[model samples]
Target: MRISQSYIILREVRFHAFHGVMPQERKVGADFTVSLRVGVDLSLPAESDDVADTLNYATLYEVVKQQMEIPSQLLEHVAGRIGKAVMDTFPQVTGVDVTLTKLNPPMGADCAGASVELHLINDKTKV
Candidate 1:
């Protein structure tokens, strides 16, 4: 039997935040959705069935929540911050993908949302 890399995902974690270049957007705020994909080795946890052997997703959510609360003008910045924070906090994570969506942005044209996605690999580890 071969054990390979596995992912722990948190999807559509929504928040209302003031994150935009426009003053009105900052004042009124808007809905934002965040999704994270965290990659790690699952062999230990698969065998031991121990929570301690795997990455704790609750902790990752808290990290994302903290970053979201700090207002920023660009979703790119927010997404980058999240990727770095997750990689820094969890050395076990070999790679991370972060998606941030801003619902009903203030553009003149009708649109459902705007989003930024970032993918990062831990340089410290060979993945």
Candidate 2:
């Protein structure tokens, strides 16, 4: 038999950034939005009501924020770094979804915005 699990979502956490391939972008950084979906075993935290038993969202935010501060040429790289960082720091994280959106991209296109999404699973051994 299979069972369903509930996940805690930290959605649409916004960050101002200077990340891009263009020089002007680095000089005049724009706003970047990051949404993180972290999957973990919550039963222990829920039953015990212990902060230590669950994922520390505050710490997670700090880790992401610090990573975003570093300038990068590609959003893909940033997203991958964020995913790896989370998995490295948190032992309970089984899966992670990272979406990085750059508002008003420099593509000079007629589109409203541009973004990239990356899904990372730590079970590299199986794949």
Candidate 3:
């Protein structure tokens, strides 16, 4: 018998935060979008129909919100922190992928945004 893993995803969670290397960028802040994919075992939840058997997306949002509140110089750092925090908070989660995007970046080009994606797997499941 084999057990299949499932995911709880939070897509395009937006926030206005101060995170940048430039002084003005920090002072004025910028728009940020975060997308998270949390992997977990869904066997129990599928049968029991109970929220307890799966990770709560609301709680995950709080974790991301808390991390975003803390300013960082780079999007990579923010994405890494989100992935680590989600894995630490949910014991059942086997892995996490976080995408953090900064809208209207200060680069002198016609672009929508810049982003960083981080993928982290639990140590026990690492191969």
Candidate 4:
């Protein structure tokens, strides 16, 4: 078997969501950026020129959006949820690299804000 690595990268997918330790953050919400590196085999789509042969990114966006809508106390938790959802929803997906960022954090630091990154492997990909 000729095994190779292929990835679909989704960048700067933004959402306004309630996720934090502070009450104000939960009530007012804040902007978040979600980027995903999805591991999948795209060789089929590349050959057939068919959308059905590939993982539809719009569906992946919806999955992330759904997870964001649910309130959470930590970025790590939310990111983990997103990674798991992708693995469960698409059998073709081998893994997910989730980077979730909280933009304009309530903290006084003048910075781009905080982020959590996670790499999750799909067990289904293992023999």
Each candidate structure's TM-score, on Cα atoms with residue i matched to residue i, is 0.94, 0.89, 0.93, 0.95
Q: Per-candidate RMSD vs. true structure?
A: 1.1, 2.5, 1.7, 1.7
TM-score of 3: 0.93
Inter-residue clash pairs, candidate 4: none
Per TM-score, what order, best first? Answer: 4, 1, 3, 2
Please list the C-alpha lDDT of all candidates, in the order they appear: 0.91, 0.84, 0.89, 0.92
For model 3, the superposed segments whose C-alpha errors exceed 4 Å read 1-3, 125-127
**lDDT, model 2, position 119:** 86
* Collision count of model 2: 0
For every model shown, the clashing-pair count is 0, 0, 0, 0
Which structure is stronger by lDDT: 1 or 2?
A: 1
The global Cα lDDT (0 to 1) of model 2 is 0.84
- Model 3: how far is 50 from its true place, Å? 0.8
Q: What is the lDDT, from 0 to 100, of the residue 31 in candidate 1?
A: 99
Candidate order by lDDT, highest to lowest? 4, 1, 3, 2
**lDDT winner among the candidates?**
4
Clashing residue pairs, candidate 3? Answer: none
Point out where model 4 deviates above 4 Å.
1-3
